[model samples]
Target: MVQRLLLAGMLSGLIVALFAFSYARVYAEPNIERAIALEEGGDHHHEEAEQGTVSRDTQRNAGLLTGLVAYCAALGGLLAIGLAFLHGRLSVRPRSAVWTLTVAGYVSLVLVPQLKYPANPPGVGSAETIGTRTEMYFIMLLASAISMAVSLWISHRMARRAGAAPSIAAGLAVFTALASLLMTMMPAISETPYDFPRALLFEFRFHAALLQLVVWGGLGVLFGQAAEYMEQSGLRVEGTARRGIPNA
Candidate 1:
């Protein structure tokens, strides 16, 4: 289990970085990088960079990269390792933890700033100008939503079958999906009274991303417990089925 978890973590990391590299190459780069002065260069000018849809191939590959590397690292290190200390099982919660980190982490970095406080030059309409670039955003948009939905849904089902406390799992899933959508709406949320968590742990938009990865440390524990239960059930089911089979 230790070794498998380790392998999973490494593979997941490799994939995630590669995905980010590709994403940086495709999505994260061109749109925002164009107007560096307005964005990274510390000018709050809003420029609307135009974009289009992200094909399924790009989306799927990104998803796989995200799901595997980014996820396993946090989950394996935090959840899995922690579980061995407490209740040991390869539950699905760690999967959720991973989903949250990778998804939230990247969005906080890429989408949040651009969407809410994008740097726009005078000509927001210009292709390179800063405005609402629906085309590019949606590429990650469609892929992440679908990825979260499928993984969360599968976890929900597994949680139910395992008779585990799935409310947290279910809530996590729904919250995750909503958060993803909300992610694209960070600017709007930032404006509203609801605001956001103010504590450095949850607040401070600049470090919003750092906070995401950091908290996964605790989220890892929860995931580990869930993972333990999942492993138990899978083993149990396998044992029962084996016993039920006739002798060869």
Candidate 2:
């Protein structure tokens, strides 16, 4: 099971990497170039200039590919581990597992934190505050993960006491209340200049969200298929071996 899941994860990661590389190369790279141009010397000028250690070519080509693959591979491995733990809890069938995991992935990883901290293009934020911003984003992510886990536990307990429908409703209500409170309490960071192109910002965020959907959705579907195949094949082998044994 572990070996099969590991292979599935690698394959799923490759799929995500390919999709990411293509989407980023097409939609994201141009916006990034434009941002670089603005930073270098454009109308949207700021007092602080962003430093660049690497050339745009490397960033667009090798750097982007490397980062995407590494991130997706690691994410896929973690997801495989999650699926392993969730085995038999969600369902024995791969299709059911896929459906459940896809929703979980989107809600826990993408939807929650994005509501608090939306994605921005290059020119939107200040270089000096990058460290602080990164720290805050990770903190938000961690909080969101904890909130999701707690909500799931609550739902499971409630389901046993009440029923599926009521449990779902109560879980959603509690999660929403908690998430809203967190969002309200968390410090907001808005560094985008008023003059910045709203359309570009929207487009960047849209593409970013789409990228997450593609990667995670692909992982769920592909990994589920792989796991199902392995399970079925193993069962078939076992059946064949049993049939070959002499009747004693």
Kindly give the stretch of ten consecutive residues in candidate 2 with the minimal lDDT sum. Answer: 43-52
* Model 2 residue pairs with clashes: none
Native-vs-model 2 lDDT? Answer: 0.78
Provide the overall lDDT of each model, using Cα atoms, as 2-decimal numbers: 0.45, 0.78
Per-residue C-alpha lDDT of model 1 across residues 1-248, encoded as one tens digit per residue? 65555454444444445534454344433333343433333444322222255543454466545653565355445434433433333343445545544454345434543444432322133344223454445544555455555555566566767655664476456646665675565433122113222332122233333333443433443343445455666678788788896433
* Candidate 1 lDDT score relative to the true structure: 0.45
TM-score, predicted candidate 2 vs. hidden true structure? 0.87
Cα miss at 162, model 1 (Å)?
A: 15
Give one clash count per candidate, in the order shown: 24, 0
Q: What lDDT does candidate 1 reach at residue 106?
A: 48
Q: How many residue pairs clash in model 1?
A: 24
